[model samples]
Target: MTDDQAYAGTAEGQGPVQIDEELARHLDNKRTELFEEFEIRDTFPDDVLIEAKNATQDPEADIEEELESGDRVDCRDLTTCTIDPVDAQDFDDAISIERLDDGRYHLWVHIADVTHYVHPGSEMWEEAVKRGNTVYLPAYTIHMLPPVLAETVCSLVPNEDRLAHTVEMKIDPETLSYEEIDIYKSVIHSDERLTYKQAEKRLDDETAELHDELTLVHELADKLHEQRKEDGSLVLNPARDRAHTIIEECMLKANKAVTHELQWVRGLEAMFRVHPQPTPQEWDKALREIQELDGVSIPGDAWDDPRKAVNATLEQAPGRQLNKIQWAVMKVMPRAKYMSDPFGGHHALNFEIYGHFTSPIRRLSDLVNHWIIYQNEGPEDHDLAELCDHASARQKAGETCERLYKQFLQEVGLDPHAVNARGLEVVEDEEDAELTEEEADTESAELDL
Candidate 1:
């Protein structure tokens, strides 16, 4: 039977029910469960990981012709700037601040010159394209770029001279928003490297040895964060939720920051991560749940008191039944995911343009985003058809690997105390027998939703 029908056998007939969200995850977890110490070759086809890794291990694109490397691109020295966690080795991005005619600050987002290092079909490039991007592990990392480039040459480290795609925008002090933006190739001279903590400290107190420019960047980040948060973008507190929440928060920050002058100056760019609003069915369910609750009036509009009405109800009926309700509340909001924006329209960000510019040091999709911005300027085509497909495919593969790995981690790291005391167990039975590919397919088709 299909997972949906199987769930129906046990619970309410509500399509495919996720039995245990935290413990019970994607369907593929079954595969990893069988082979904890997985060897990619043994479980999956040889072409799965090796083929991609070898294919793009080195990029073959002609640098002098396609890329604006030497003196051809905008090479304004911005080495005085530094980025990342206090002791970050990979510098994917840097910022430059300048005063303009109206005394407004012209902020420049300088992304690492990745195109200069990785080109299409190259071993490294193809591997990156195949790998899609760097996968950050709990304690290690599967980088998109080799240490030679990602951590050193193309890292955008302070005091280093490197090529860049500079997105210069005029910021209004009063609004703390961008008035105008310009994107182009440029060189930079970073004055000093600053960490998030160090920068925040400077903002909290003056004369704390923090550079003036560092303080300004933090302030600008706040303004940008506020502007986006006001636009329906949910930036949650990681501490209040789970580990994945932090990842979501950091990625959202990067996604917001990525919409620099180059990718978003003129038109709406695509968003790689978006969770569109809930569906009508889900909204209806939520309304019914609220209406039936004790002393709760049927909200005229679910969007009106989403935080209060929706969240409060979920809190009250915090059980298996509430999971569906939570999902329905999500339906009422718009989804912000990977879609090609026509004119840089990020409806969720409420901005005309947006792109994933940050985290290029690890993500190939961001690299492709850089390529898109580059080609749009004067190049004939952005080659998005191939790049987008590669990005999507790689993203899927990376997710599969990460999922399997996490399942392995979960299985290996199960708490003995919790398992015995709280009654969590791993039991194998004939009914739960491992299904072959064909059997699984047949079993799924046997059941109708």
Candidate 2:
């Protein structure tokens, strides 16, 4: 599910709500029930955790070895920065951009090289395949990889040299198309980390550290976003801010570049995202429903393309009706799935070829693609189609679990958005504090797999 769909009516940046012990227990029980119903694994196996701990033991020595062996490119000199949510734990991606003398743009997207640590024949790899992707609940997260590994070595923390899979693109100034693309392994040092709010501030303040770079990138990202809308791409979130636009456009460009290399240049099979278009009748039904909404109108010029029509309506629709408009479109839209062939293009993104590459830490498809690109070989013993099906199923299950969990929170008179933003604080009586601590310890021990 998209962010707008998952968090439709929730306000952002709310403070944490204090809950009594009784309510906290109720929330915990509901989460346990949902996990069982969806078959979501909440704990890592002992072997996987042990392997992750061992892998992160000597990071400095490993970097020196990799650099000395000439297997990785040296990019620590570049000015790189990561932009994520304020509460983000593990930073998986970062970006750096520059304006060239020829009026073109040079963009570098660096993603954590997760395949270097978790590959085939490893316990962590097996567990990651079983999980498929990270399951995110309100104020909670079930990581695909062990946190000891993902949060330490694989995280792109600031002021640290870390291994990365970098996509370097030289984009045309006029067309916003890639003039040159290069994908390679590198070691990078992030100069700083900025939250989404901080990034917006940088864009407004000319005296900020990364003000120039952010300004240049936002210009390119805005143009790219406009180009996507013009080419019939469906954008559900019309109010997305400049920080989000910069990140979204850059990641889409990098993912497209990697998949284009895999299919057209290398002639190999990888997990491609294929979103089937809704039937013509279904599109008509959605349009009719949207038109009936008060104060909403679809321009006549965009009627030929349903995606464009929705985009146009959303831009002009009232803020209160945004959720309804999105639901109208989503009800008729087909769920996108992964496939070994890139023949069926993604209907929503309106890309001829698209796949995952920028988020290897949480997604199985991106992790598999990283391995394939690095080794230049497809999985010989594995069924690619089966993997694709498993990923799609698990993703659906995760989404369902999250939806149910959020509904339960609302039923209990707690704001899901508030809990998600500021987290929950369990308030206990003075006499029950010790007992509560004991019970929590017991529960922690039970969860340590």
Tell me the lDDT of model 2 at 250: 90
lDDT of 1 by residue, 99-125 (tens): 668878767777776876566555556
**TM-score, cand. 1:** 0.59
lDDT of 2 by residue, 1-449 (tens): 43212222322544355777888788889889998999999998899999998888988788888999999999998889988776676888999999999999999999999988999889998899899999888788999899976777989988888999999999999999899999999999998888787788889988888899999999999999999999988888888889988988999999999998999899988888888989999999999999999999999998999999999998998977777888888899888898988887888899987898988888999999999898887655668888889998998999899989977877776666556656776767633321111111010000000
| Clashes found in each candidate (C-alpha, N, C closer than 3 A) | 56, 0
Candidate 1 residue spans exceeding 4 A from truth = 1-79, 86-89, 98-101, 175-177, 238-275, 283-302, 305-337, 340-353, 377-383, 414-449
Q: Give Cα-based local distance difference scores for all models.
A: 0.49, 0.84
